[model samples]
Target chain A: MEILIIILLPIICTIMIAAVGRKSVFLRNLFVLIPTVGDFLLVGHLAWQVKSGGTAASLNLVDLSNFAIKFEASGISVYMALSMTFLWIMTAIYSFGYMEHEHAQVRYYAALVLNLAAAMGIVFASNLVTFFIFFELLTIAVYPLVVHEETDAAYLAGKVYGVYLLTGGAMVLMATVVLYCLTGTFDFVPGGIPALAQQSTFMLTVLFVLFTIGFGFKAALVPLCYWLPEAMIAPTPISAVLHAVAVVNVGVFGFVRVIYNIFGPTLYNKMGFGSVIAVMAAITILYSAFQGLRQKEIKRMLAMSTINQLSFMLLGLVSFSMIGMTGGLLHIYYHSFMKITLFYCAGAIITQSKNKYVANMGGLAKHMPITMTCFAVAAVGIVGLPPVAGWVSKWYMMQGFLEMGKPIYAIIFLLSSLIELGFFGPPIFRAFFRKEENNSFNFQQDTSKFGSEAPWAMLAPIVIVAFFSVLFGFWGFVPHGLVKPALSGLLGKGF
Target chain B: MITNSWLLFFAVFIPLVSAPLSLIFSDKVSNRFTALSNVVNFLVIAGMYSAVSHGKLLVLELNTGFNFKLSFMADSLSLLCGLIFIAVWTLTSFYSIGYMSHEHAQRRYNLFSLLSLAGTLGVVFTRNLFSLYIFFEILSVASYVMVVHEESFEARKAGLKYILMGIIGGLTLLLAMVCTYHITGTVDLL
Candidate 1:
């Protein structure tokens, strides 16, 4: 029941907000705050339960003769659920100011809550059926938020988003049924499902292809991508969560689940599927970084960079070792905080200075020092500089690949970092040293004026999440300690 | 294993079970009921997870004979796919409430969407390849209305293309099924 309520709370709030949110601004604001805060506490308690070495909290809400609807909060699920709720609360708080002037507040807030619920559902679902359900829900629920502006471009983006995801969903459904026919079960046993080993090579290969294409569309794997950058027409907070926290994370989670939970490392290695995925991820890493450099729009550039960074996580996951998988899972948490900080900063700059293109900002640092500082810090973190969270994950990922005797992947990792620096480095450099050619700043005047920076609601979350990026870097022990056990539980082997 | 055969059968055929009601009621009522049934279907699938994981499989056999028998099995995998199918359908229904607010033929859209969902769920739960093939075809036919929901010329053209491709695919699958059945002297893989 407790587990059920955890999933239902956001849904309940969504309905309430949708019903009463339009009439009273105070009620709308309160509706968003109370549910998000409640979710934080509920997930916090679940974390405590896991830390105390209790059995993972579970609920079987519907019981049939042959199956049941199951929700389980294992260590990994708890870790991710906690991160999701935390980011959600912060995003909700940030939305208070970011969306102040936006129209259709009711729809925006309602969809935001629904998206969180669906994201949480994805994290906590105990099996593929459960996961896929929430996964598709996320795709549909986010459509409203994506097309909230109701512009021609927004509608086009929405169509693109729908087509890509629904098609992916269909393939997933077909693969899932075929998988059932072969294996007779879809429960996510640790390592790999033993029954799957009995399948013929042709059948197994087909399943692999189906699962990859199904999840890859959402993960934005190359060739099947382009929808992600198009999805940038969404509102800034929506963009921030979609890119950093919710949608992409679910995609990577599904990919990792297929490799680690469904296929297991031993079988994955024996079949040589790891290298195939690693190669794909490596290409995505390099290609998106190059694309990032070419984008003129700030958000589009960040979207490109997100595709790049996400593949780093994918590469780490397919390393097929305890350390590699740990790095992969840990990167999910670390990247969420770090990339979300960057997106938040981007959104803040746009909301404040009305500059959507990077080229338009000649001397942004001269005025919005706080926002620029946060952006620079996150950019350095993303480039794998020391004492930032991104570096910690990349280090473990490189080590994992080398331990697996795959030095090529490690080299790819190194090259991708340089690419990251190439794109993220310049904006910071231009902000501080190289002033824009068409500048608007009055240097002689006091630049620390209150209005020069974004409002407190917007600026506070950026600074907080950025601080966490650096703080996690320095205190890498915390996530390393958490994710290690989670990966171990899934792999059924202690590192 | 406790096998409630009637309930299990109804779970897979719920869309057909509710079709009569859908046709009789107003669009709003039918939409709400269809959405409610999907939620119920999702819960039923979820409830079966523990039993399936415990190795308590549900097998419904039809036309039993010495040489061949038709069967439908509920295992972990089928149940999992069923969950995803119902989830997508339910969310689409909710989204359509808002998305189709200004559209005509909403009743037609809702009915076809429900029928497509039925075909999809059947495809997931059917144990034999022949039944699987049948459900796949049903899904293809039912989903045509969704493709052409807009009633625009482009929509009609797209719908025609969609049905043509679906038919071609169905024919190819049917040919394969015939060969397999003739070669093996049985249509069921299980």
Candidate 2:
């Protein structure tokens, strides 16, 4: 019950404030601030409880005398909830001044809170059914945020988002029904569906494909991934939440939950689907990395890169090795911080200097040193360079592939890392070292004469997250008793 | 006995009620008042979240004039969606304050926003396929007003396209629901 309150309080407060703050701008803004802090504290408390090895609280509500409402947090859920709440607090703080001059500041804040609440719900959900509900809610909640610009391009992007996700959502709904009918329960159990394991392999194979495609849309595996790059049409804060933290993470999280909890590695291994999944993941990684190299728009490149990086996590999981699952989970946090920094830097460049393309970013490092520096650190992290968080995950993935004796995947992983360097390295290098063109690109008065580096609101979150990229990397090196045990609980012993 | 179920029914009704209230108050003060009503309704929903989170299930059961009971339950899944609906409703309200500040029919917009939220909440909370269909249709109707809120030809055209596609999706959903109920002998979610 207490745990549930932590998630619901902000949502309640957001509505009350919006209603009451109608006439007073100061009051409205002030009202929004209260819930932002309140939710963060709640998440912090949950994290503390988890770190101390406390048992998670559970809540169940019965509806229509038939269905049950259930929520619980294990160590994994608590950690993820804390990550989301922490990022949300920073993003909300940033949105404060970022929306100062924008119209509909109230709506922006309200949407931010809603997105946060849905994300937290996703993190804490105890079962696949609950997870799917929040997953779809996340999809709808983000649509308006994406079309916040209300331009033709934004509208079109919103449409593509609807088509891809809604279709995928339908598949999830169908799969859930099928599973429920077979098992008579929708709760996530570690190891997987014992009942399904008893069924014919052909039936299980079909079901596995359904589950894979349903979850794969959000994971952004190729053919189903076109929606992600287009979704970059949303605002920067939205990009941070949707692409890096909440939306995509929910997809990846669902995939892990389904594989490890519903199917269990033992059965998944016996089914011979692990190799198939790995092959698809490797293809997506190399393919999207190649796509990222050809993009000129910084956000589009980052979006393509997200598809590729996401595949890295999937590849790690598909290896079914302990090292691989750990790599996958760590990458969830590491990739989020790194990608968010890159997106923030891109947003800052666009908003501050009106530069959206890499071709135009020559000499940017000199003008906006803080933004470019953060961008460079983040780029290194994304490229899997040492001492950065991305390196830890990539290293574990390599070990996982090797342990699985999949030499082809190990080679592909290395090739993909090099491709990552190919795509992310040159842009940062060119930003700093390349000479300014003699054309109109040079001698142009500093665009920031009108504004300094993006408002402190925006810059603060990016910088803090960049710092987290390094901090989490170091944390990965230290023996954290919590994460390893949690991974063991999910993956089982002998992992 | 039916009155208890009205609470769940009212979750959907409040928005439709607000629509008329907005029409009646179509002035500035009325718009403020309508916003206030929405806030109040949102708070009640929040209370529901708390009650549900506390392991209390708020079940509203109604006979659909057919054989089945039209039911709404605040389960974990519904609670998640309800939380999101209320949150988005609040923010979009604030946003509309800025985005639609100078537009006419501010009351209409607020009314429809509430209706959409209510409809969406109903879709998530209800366990019955029939009720889900009803709420889904309401959501479709209510959101169209938002898509066409600008009342411009382009906005109206987009709304039309949105509605047409939604209708097609709705029909598919309806067929699925009917097939499910026919095969299972109940529209209630297990």
Candidate 3:
């Protein structure tokens, strides 16, 4: 029953928001907050239950002899769901301030809510069929948000986003069909299906390539990263929620499920897939950081940063060791906090000051002290500084690399930290140190007040998420709690 | 909160929590405050040393998710480290009262010295690599201010090099811990 409602509620709320929005704008806004908040609670509750030795809810629909659609809140499912819905709540609350002047409120809210259901579906899926279905739905759901402005540029970005993802979807669907035929099952198992090891090596290799290409596109691994920065043509809210938080994460989560659930680390290790992924993710980490440094636009730089950061999680997943996997999985939770906070600040800055480039953001901190301060905190976290969430995960990732005897990946991670500083530092330095000539922007003091400096709505989520990034760093129980259980359960290792 | 080991927290955190307090008080008051806190801190650990020396294993565990607790164990080894840290801390509190009188930025020195003491005690009491790493990081970071406390040109450069080595050391320790955890499937020390 809990599983049914968890899956069904988002669609129900999306329909309600679309219908109620036509009658009252206030109701529409209220409706927008309900589903994400509710989803977060439901998902978080499921995570707690599963962590405390309760079996997660599993559901099946249209059972057709090994081809049924199934949803199960396994440890990793709850891991992804908890973070997605939590950030979804932030995005929902944030849009109230950021999207006030934007066009098409009804369509935006409806699509945003639907994206939540799709994300929840992808995470909770018990089979390749269910995972693929939700994965494709997420692609279609985010299109409206992608080309939200309906501008030529938005349309162009929409086309790139669609073309890249749809082609990847085709590859994944092909892989799923082949996998089901080879294994006579569509259900996902923690650690690869034992029967897969019996298949011909050549066939398994082909299937592996298909799944990698499919997930790698959305994961924004090097060659496929062009669409990510292209999609920056969308509004900052979409950039933050779908692009930074949800859409891209779904891609890495796919890599995670495939590595652990589908392929099993033993087979992944035997096939030398860790080395393959380490190379690809390593390339993406370096190349995208360089790309990020070249981008003059704030959101574009963040997009490049997202592409770089996503691979960090991807790299952790294939670390071929539990510790590496732990670091990678923890990163999925931690990066959302750091990256989303950054997007909120970037969006808030763009909206209030009309300054989008790094150079022009000089002395913007004096205007929006709260936003810039949060930006600096998140920037420090991204740089892997201690007592911020990013350091813990990166510390683990570095260890995972060393544990696997792949110190090269560890070196790559360290190099990215410096590059992260390079890309994130200039904006912060310019914001605080560089002077804005003829500055006329209203200075917002007393960050505690409502509607101060970019509206309480936007400021609140930015500050709260930033605070959690710090909290998760110091409060060992909160972020680390869920991840270790989830990863241990997946690896079948009792900690 | 586990057992009667609540005083273990006071041993480490009293020094930590009292750090910023020096900024508010004058030199004499700050000196007295530091002395009082360190004496209290020493007593907390010294009292535990009696039980610990008898192999009582004054264990305190804070729930940190999974089945893994952030357990603080004061066996003979940790009690020894704890006693030594707080003892030195207590001695310095008196010594610095006069030592800091002629020093510029005495409050700043007082503040970081207190912070580093707690960080050291936390390192001493932790039963696992993860908790030790946390306190070790704080200690390393807190020591940087003292490295540059003199505010001279050489002090700044030496401070930079000191912190760079500290960060590298921290990263190396983290790598070793990860390797240990990967093999053991737990961050705890046996």
Candidate 4:
């Protein structure tokens, strides 16, 4: 019953806002505020329950014996749900003022709500079919938000986004159907399909390929990563949410789900696929970091960085060790906060100074100290510096890799970290140290002559997220009581 | 038996109710009304989630053209997806206040967006291959309107391509569904 309310609240809000938006601004804003607060409370309650060792709730649809729409908050799911809701509240607060000057405000708000709802659903789903349904819906829900600008560039970007994700969705759907056909059920029980291992090795390998390609597209592993960079044409807020928090996170989260829930650690170890996955992830981490170095566009650089960071999670997953899985899970939260902070700063610079290239950002630290400081902190975190959230996860990832007796993977991990630092460190260094170019201040003054910083509405969320990025690191906590046990249930003691 | 199936009716009717209600009102009034309907619909979903979270099953059955019953089930997986849909829709609504303010055909966009929600939820709740296909098509068609909301030549082109590709995908899915049904003698998902 609680699960139904969580799902229904937003749909009701959408209807109310769409209806009220045309007539009364007060009513429109009121309708939007009510549900945002409600959802936050609802998720908070669920988190508290999970923390108290209470079992998460599951709602089964009775009309269909074979079909069940469920909601269960395991440690992992609760963590993800809480993180999403937290960021969303901030994004909502940011959008209230950011959209004030924009046209077509109603559509923008509606899409935002729809995307949030879809993201939450992805976190809570317990089966492959249910997850796939929301996964595809997420792609659809985010498209309008991407193309909200209605420009030719936005359209083209939207097309690329559609093609990449839909093709990936097709692959996932096919694999899901095949898996369901072979197995009687599609539930994500831990320890994977034992019957699957008994099948022909050739069939298992084929299934593995299909699953990797499907999951990899969202995870942005090398070959399928172009869409992410292209997707940067979206509005700054949309970019922050989709690239930094929601859309990309779903992909990595799905990867975790597949590995921990569907494949199970013992089955994964027996198949000898962990080495293959590890190598693939290592290559992506190094490749994307190098690519980040060559890019001039700040958003593009960040996009590439996301591709690299996501691989860290994948590497942890394939590590087949406890430390590795924990590190991977920790990275999800760590990376989300850090990346969102960077994106917020990027958006601030662009919105305030009309500059998109890093080359033009000299001496920004002097003019927009708050934003630049936040950017620097986030960059440091991304580089895996101490006292920031990123290091905790990166350390665990390294430990996991080393524990597996794969010293070479540990070397690759360290080398990739250095490469990450190599690309990310320079931009912050240049932004603060370099003398302002003659043309640099021209654009900065042209757009933001009225003020050197973005509105409080925008700045506030960045500051909050940046603070949490550091704070979570200082705490050095991984809320694994919920997820770890659930994972144990799925993977057995081998995990 | 039919009366006990209120959950199924609520699942389908909550958002579906908004379409006619939205269309009936004047453009300005209908938009607000549609927003209200969406809010109400989402509230109903929240209630459904509550029911499910309490360890109850929210299921409904509808008669199909062929002597078949279309089943809709609310389990943890679907509830999760449903939660996300409602949440994102809520935020997007706030965003749309600013985004859709100036569009000429505001009513049309609002209507289709709500219908898209209905179709999305329909897909989330349904239990069989056949219903999944039906709702999937509905979602595809409804969202196509949103893709072409601007009605520019470029928007139209994109929409056409999207529709065509969707049709191809749908046909492929239909073929797959038929194959499954042939093999199993029923299209049940579980």
Candidate 5:
């Protein structure tokens, strides 16, 4: 019951906000912010309970003979839930200012909260059925957000988004049903389903292919992806949740559950799923990096870079080594903070200066110094070039890949970093290094006259999440401690 | 007091009924009608989750006559996949409300989309290679109309390429099915 409340609170509040939000802006924003903060507190309490007691708390909503819908707070679920809740809170705060003058406040606030609920449901689900239900709901709930702009282009993007993700959902559904028929249970066991090993290699291979392609859609695997870039038609906060926090990581979460909990390391090795996933991850990593360079829109470039960076987590999981999985899991947290910061900075820039194109953003630091500096910090962290969160996760990923006897992945990582720098380094270089453009009406000049920065609502969250990216670099265990027990769940006791 | 077979039966039958219905109705009526049909299809399949999870695989056999048989296999996997197709189709139907409101021939578009839905459901639920091949062709043929629904120059050209590739695929599948039937003396998979 306690666990269930944590999931339902945001949804209930979403309804409340939608119902009463039309009255006033302050009340509307309050309804949105209160639930997010409330969910964060509830999740924090749940995390404390899990950490102190060392056992998961679960609630079962339905039992239909062999299949049951249950939500549990295991180490992995707790970690993901906490991270998602934190991002939701940050996004809500940022939206308070970003959406001040925007229309459709009621719809926007409702969808935002509902999206958080669906994401938390994904994190807390103990079985495949629960996860699938929430995952499908997520597809529907976020559609309104994507098409919120209501332009012809947004509708077309929404259609493409629906086709791609639901097709992926279809494949995932196929795999789930097949696994249930074979094993007679949908509960996620820690170290793989034992019965799965007894199945024929052909059956196993078919299941793997279905699961991979299904989850790969949102994970942005190379061949089956183009929707993520197109989905940037959404508003910035929604894009942050899509790219940094919720949708993409849920896809990665699916991969984690599939690899560690469904197939486990032993079976994953025996079946050689690692090599298959590694090849896909390697291609997406470098390909998206090079592709990011061609993007002129800052958000689209970040979207492409997101597609690139997300593959690191996938490669980490497919390495099938403990350190690799740890790195992958930790990167989920590290990347969330870093990427959300970058997106927040981008959003602030857009809201403040209306500078959407990177080519026109030269010498932006003269006015928006804090925003550009935060962007630079995040950009450096993404390149893994310094003593930051990205470096820590990258070191572990490289070590994991090398230990798995796949040095090609290590090379891919190194090369993608160089290419990553190529795209992200320019804005920083142009911001501070180059002279400010001579346009008399540039926002930089106008804002410089008043010494204005982004509104406090937006600037605070940007600074906070960016600060975490650097803070976590020095003290890795803040998020890492949450992940260690989950890693051990896959790698046996010592890990 | 619905039996598991009823659920399986309606899951396959509703789309068949809606395909023609989509063609006859006025634009507004047909849109709502197709959207309603999608919802009902999704509900029927969701109800099958219990029986499916109970490990009672719902197999409905249709006797077409003269020792020929067609079967719909509602194993957990097929049922789940059925749910996916219905769900996507439902959302797309709603999306089409906003997307196709301005386009010409709304009735025709609704008709082909609903027809393709039926065909896709057939492909997802069929168990035997013979039935799978048949429904696969049904899906390909129905969706080809959608690819060319715009009837623009580019849509026509793409439709031509689509039909060409589809024929090649259909022929390859037919050859494989024929070879397997000849070698094994049966078309059912397991």
Candidate 6:
């Protein structure tokens, strides 16, 4: 029932939105807001239920032929669902302020809520077919939000996104069909599907290629990566949510499902698929870092940085060790919090001052001290600096690499961290150390539509998400409560 | 919810049927008509989409009394494209109201736009080379009017180049159709 309500609630809310939207803005906003908060509580309740009971909550809707439309909330999925819902709460608040001047609130909010529903479906999906269905739904649901601006650039990026995802979806469908044919099961067992281990190495390898290449379009893995940067033309809220929570997360989350659920860690290790993915992820990490350094726009830079960081999560997951997988899962939560914080800051800056370029953000801290402070904190978290949650995840990932007898991966992780600092550090520094090149803008004026300090609606989420990135750093045990159950749930009790 | 309802099969023809309605109205009225028709088209296609996703394969078979058969399948892939096309066309309808507010020949643009959309819908819906070739031809030719709507030397020049290239491409498609039918004695795409 938790699983059913989690998927159906937002869809119901979206219907209510279309009905209520024409009557009053407040009611429409309420329909969207209520479900987000409600979903977080419900998912939290469900997560707690799983943690305590040691039994996942499952929903079997129907059986189609030999397949079933089902949902289950395991430890890691609960963590992902929690992260998405939590980030959505922030996105909803940030959007209320950010979209004040924008058109199409009915369409935007509806798509946003529907997207929230689709994302929940992705995380809670217990099988490959169910995951694939929600995966495609997610792509379709986010379209209106991404193209909300209706500008030429927005459409261009939307075109790139559509073409890529369409082809990607078809590839994924083919792969799913092939896997179902080979093994006759779509259930995601924790370690590895034992039956899949008996398949020929060549068949499994090709299946891996199909799944990776298909999912890589969304994950923005190097050759399939330009769409992420191009997607920056969307409204800042869309960019933030897509980068942090929904769209890209779906891709990386697909990778998690592929590695753990579909391939399983042990079989994946034996097949040596982990090494190939790690190498690809390493290239993406380093290459995106360099690309990020050259980006002038803060959002695009964040976009590149996102491509870099998502690979970090992938690298960790494919690192072929328990600690590595743990690090990967932790980063999924950490990255969303940190990245959303950074994006919310960027959105606030873009909205308040009408400034977007990093080159112009010099002395920005003087004007928006609160925003830059949040940015600084998130930047520290992203680069794995001490006393932040990012450090905890990165430390584990590096340790996992070393434990696996792969010092080179550890070195690659270190190098990307420095490059990330080179990219992220400058904006925060210039925001403080340098002088405002444009003197006409005045924070004291408070003339913008939002407020003197980027409306509370926007700033609050940024500060809150940023603060969580720090809180998780200090309250490290909280992650263990989740990750241990998740790891053990998949690998069995002894693990 | 899954049904082999006949409306689901011929739903692609809704646009082709409405394309002429745009020519019957003036500029202001045509925009609204286009919007209305597109909404109707969207709702029907959306219904088709629901049926397809729920495991109903919406197929249309035609006996043309020639050496060829016309086959159309609204698989999930085509339905997705159909849905996207309608959404984009609806958005484009709203967009043109603002962007083309000052433009002339709005009626001509509106008429061809629906016709081209019909063409696209046909192309996406068909599962056989026979129908695909016929729809592909409609799409290329209908698009010519849109390119030449400006009615200037450059517009005509570009339109000519576009149509010529489109024709060449169509011919290549025909070549492929011939090869497939000659070999398989049928043009069904699986």
Candidate of highest DockQ: 3
Q: Which predicted model would earn the best lDDT? A: 3
The per-residue C-alpha lDDT of model 2 at residue A56 equals 65
> What does candidate 4's lDDT look like per residue over A349-384, in tens digits?
887777889888876765676788799878867866
- Candidate 6 has a DockQ of 0.01
Evaluate candidate 2 by giving its C-alpha RMSD to the native, one decimal: 26.1
lDDT string, candidate 5, B82-135, tens digits: 888899999999998888888876876787787678778877877676557555
Q: Provide the lDDT at A182 for model 3.
A: 95
Q: Pick the candidate with the highest TM-score.
A: 3
Q: DockQ of candidates 1 onward, in order?
A: 0.01, 0.01, 0.24, 0.01, 0.01, 0.01
lDDT of 6: 0.80
TM-scores for every predicted model: 0.71, 0.69, 0.81, 0.70, 0.71, 0.71
Model 1 chain B is weakest, by summed lDDT over 10 consecutive residues, at B62-71
Model 2 bad stretches (over 4 Å): A20-22, A63-66, A438-451, A477-481, A492-495, B1-190
| Tens-digit lDDT track of model 5 for A373-392 | 78987886787643346765
Question: A294, model 6: CA deviation in Å?
Answer: 0.5
Candidate 1 segments whose C-alpha is farther than 4 A from its true place: A439-448, A493-495, B1-190
Please give, for residues A102-138, the per-residue lDDT of candidate 2 as tens digits: 6666677777777777877777777767777778888
Q: The CA-based lDDT of model 1 is what?
A: 0.78
Docking class of 2: incorrect
Q: What is the C-alpha lDDT of each candidate?
A: 0.78, 0.73, 0.82, 0.74, 0.79, 0.80
Query: What are the per-residue Cα lDDT tens digits for candidate 1 across A29-84?
Result: 88898878888889888888777787888877665644556688888787888888
Error of 6 at A425 (Å): 1.9
Which residue pairs overlap in candidate 5's backbone? none
Candidate 5 segments exceeding 4 Å error: A438-445, A449-452, A490-495, B1-190
- What interface-residue Cα RMSD does candidate 1 give after superposition? 28.0
